[model samples]
Target: MVLPALMLFVAVVLIPLAMTVLLSFNDWGQYKGIEQVFILKNWREIWEDDYFLEMFLRTFRIAVLATLITALLGAPEAYILNRMQGRWKGFFLLVILGPLLISVVARTLGWALLFGGANGVVNKALMSLGVIGAPIPFMFTETGVVVALAHVMMPFMVLSVWAALQRVDPQIENAAMSLGAGHATILRRIVLPQIMPGILSGAIIVFSLSASAFATPSIIGGRRLKVAATLAYDEFLNTLNWPLGAAVAVLLLVALVLIVVGSNALIERRYAEVFR
Candidate 1:
């Protein structure tokens, strides 16, 4: 049973990944196009270039911020949703997930319109509310990208924490309350610990997706602010530097794999007794 699945995985995922890795070792030029010869030129260029360094750092920074925002907001929202009863729960859940039903491109374009510089809807609304003295730049900025990406990725975080909440015993809270534990203490000690796995799982999902995200970042950050994904896209499509793009993509994949695996290991260790 597992053999067939493993074979399918190798065929669908591993083959393309291996090919991409091989392609990264090949050479490319403006006039020459892609040359079949294997070399470390692409990798070496990425390693030595400060531009690549800044771009990767910016990419991870945005991903981290987006993940943190989602965790902070989504965890609480999920808790609230879990506590609600009947149709109200379903209604709010639907509203929370409405964004997921739309095309990511469409959603991002909507954000682009809202984030239309100083005259944008967001800025105007804030100005009207006296939230700021002047318009803030949203279009073509990292803040815009982070905000959009967080919105896009929020559903995953909420759903993950909701699932974790399902495994939690409601009586535990009651038991703690019976022992003279206040609401805050019960929540801090009993609820959060139980839901931690979900939060970590959601963080992994959000962070990984955010890091590799292309569309939202491209639309929000524009040409001036380039993340790793957009930079790879430019190299492949605009510059016609497929080898270089492949290298960048492979590096991103490797980084994400390492980070996710490390995160999982830490989570497992920390939650060993609880999970067991």
Candidate 2:
């Protein structure tokens, strides 16, 4: 049973991945078919391009910031949710998950409307309250992209941390509280360690999703901001540079893999050091 599933997975994922790796090495200048003349030109050129580097760095920064924001927002919510009971729990859970049901494009478009200049709802409300004389720049900005990505990724972080919190024994917290342990101490020493795995998982998912996101960034960030994903889109679709686009895609994939693996390793190392 597992063998068939594994084979199917390899066929769908690994095969394309292998092809992408191969494509990244070849130069396909104005050619439609797969180029046989393989070289290091594509990777070398992309690596040296300042614009490409800027886009990659921006993508990385956005992903990290979004993941951190999600964690900060989600962690406390998860802790609170774990303490809740009955109908309220389910209702709140549904609320957190409500955005997931909406299409990504639709969600992004909604944000675009809210972040629109001058007459936008958010700007209008803020202006009415005398918060600002003029609308703050959001549309086509990095801040706009990060805000929307965080909103989209928050649910995953919340659910992951919530699941982790569920596994924690409440009696342990009760015992700590009875022993006169401060809330901060209990949270730092007990709650955080147990939920670290969940945070790590959530961070990985959020970071990967945000880094690869095209629709939200493209729509919200507009042409002014260019992340690695958008650059890849332009290279492949707009410029028709398949090899270069493939190289960019490979680099993005490698970056995600490193982030995931590096996070796991760091967590494991910290756990060992703390325990030892």
Best-performing candidate as measured by TM-score: 1
* Cα RMSD for candidates in order: 1.5, 1.9
lDDT measured at residue 76 in model 1 versus the true structure, 0 to 100: 96
The TM-score measured for candidate 2 stands at 0.93
Q: TM per model? A: 0.96, 0.93
Model 1's alpha-carbon lDDT is 0.95
TM-score of candidate 1 to 2 decimals: 0.96
Per-residue C-alpha lDDT of model 2 across residues 119-220, encoded as one tens digit per residue: 888889989999999888889888889999999889999999999998999999999999999999999998999999899888889999999999999999
lDDT per residue (tens digit) for residues 52-160 in model 1 = 9999999999999999999999999999999999999999999999999999999999999898878999999999999999998888888899999999999999999
lDDT scores of the candidates, listed in order:
0.95, 0.91
Off by over 4 Å in 2: 31-34, 127-133
